[model samples]
Target: MRKPWCSTSSLALALVTVIVVGLAGAANAQGAAPAPAGPPPPAPTADEIKKVTEYYLRGKDVGPILMELVVCKKMGKSAENKSICEEKHGDTLKKGDPLIAFTRFFVPKGAKYEDLKVKFLLNGEVRSTSDFTLQESWTGYGNYKQTTASKPGTWEILVLRGETQLATAKVTVVE
Candidate 1:
């Protein structure tokens, strides 16, 4: 017969201990406890977009920003041929120039975001609307831009996510 030390209760206790130790080991294998969770930051508004672009991109004095139009720019084509500001900044684009838009920017954590709602404003009027979705990359920054013929004036480009503006720039289009 079996010994008293190998009773049913003893086996059950041993099994539980093994299970507990295995679970603890698994948890340890995983990294440390994640940071406290909370609601994400509210997307900045058009007004907020202006402020941020001004602070980081532009100085206290909001001066006119020239659009960096480009020729070999791909609005968003093949996977390998997608346009990026870091790659293609701007080209020569004149007034009444169809599909003449210099599209690209350096997003802080662009990959974490969605397609940004973009608007091209002239002098203060809305010229065109474009939405940008950040493509995957080695860096968090991504690029997406829209091209449309513009009139001769100051083209205020506002990059937005919803009503909140993410970035801003000004481009002078001449005739």
Candidate 2:
């Protein structure tokens, strides 16, 4: 005959195993919680784009200007054989992310603290602007290592030197 204590111990073990298996099954049925939805898409209307583009093109306050985008590494230098300022500034820029280092440039050689005016444009609309004295400079060129939050889309940057507007660079920032 089996010992009474042995039978009790075996029963307890089986009960525990069943409970664990049941809990595991329940957990598997639940699975992981569904991931939260992301933010809504940002799409500009055709009219809006036209209006913004017209504003930049028609603005007479600043003289004729040409803009370009430049992309580089974190060392504040242009990457090898990479266009410093052209259609695209950086390889990638996320929505609401800060400005990437070594991804921007301007003309007019060294911009004086009082003779510089910089503006950021999203889809041709002005999003932000800063003067030369307001922010620190990167070498003789404008600073690019500073962090500044920006919306994702076709972006353009305008740099003005005194009364003469220097250059503007456009880039696409993906979401």
Candidate 3:
């Protein structure tokens, strides 16, 4: 009887030891590695990043106007602007006109053209605002022409649907 009791106690102690070791191994595995920390990854840019601002003119959903801004360092070399002086049809602007044009993109998938509102902002302040009505579709490519009132600093083109702001762009204006 004494021998059997001693044998059972030894088996129980061995089992406890094994259980403790397995629990320790699991704890170490759970704390094995730490996650990396840093700023969010940058947005991918195209080889030619066409900066455009969208103006939501009509509909319940406003979209953005897109424009391309030439960066100063690559201005004379990489950037190219073809003049439309050949015929009267291409002359969207008169001589010595101070205006910036942008292409608009609308939102909410099937929104009509007559239901949007668009606005332009300079350094977080409103510079010009406009409204449009879509007779046919919800969104299409369009342009907004704004004459420069003062030397362009930091300008933002914002699109809105009703009261919600959809998208925005920040561009530096050069004299």
Computed on alpha carbons, the lDDT of every model, listed in order, comes to 0.48, 0.46, 0.41
Q: What is the per-residue lDDT of model 3 for residues 27-51, given as tens digits with 9 covering 90 to 100?
A: 3343311222688767544321212
Candidate 3, after superposition: displacement of residue 8 in Å? 77
Cα miss at 12, model 2 (Å)?
99
Candidate 1 per-residue lDDT over residues 54-85, each given as its tens digit: 33333313222222334322344444334432
Q: Over all chains combined, what TM-score does candidate 1 have?
A: 0.41
Please list the Cα RMSD from the true structure of every candidate, rounded to 1 decimal place.
17.7, 25.4, 21.4
Q: What is the lDDT of residue 3 in candidate 3?
A: 48
Q: Taking the candidates one at a time, how many backbone clashes does each contain?
A: 10, 8, 22
Q: lDDT per residue, candidate 2, 1-175, as tens digits?
A: 8657668657755765565466445433433122226986677765664443444334334322233334422332334222232222365666765553232232221222455566777788877766644211111122442334466778766667676666666567776
Error of 1 at 122 (Å): 1.2
Q: How much is the lDDT of residue 14 in candidate 1?
A: 80
Runs in model 3 deviating more than 4 A are 1-101, 104-113, 138-145
Q: Pick the candidate with the highest TM-score.
A: 1
Off by over 4 Å in 1: 1-79, 85-93, 98-112, 134-138
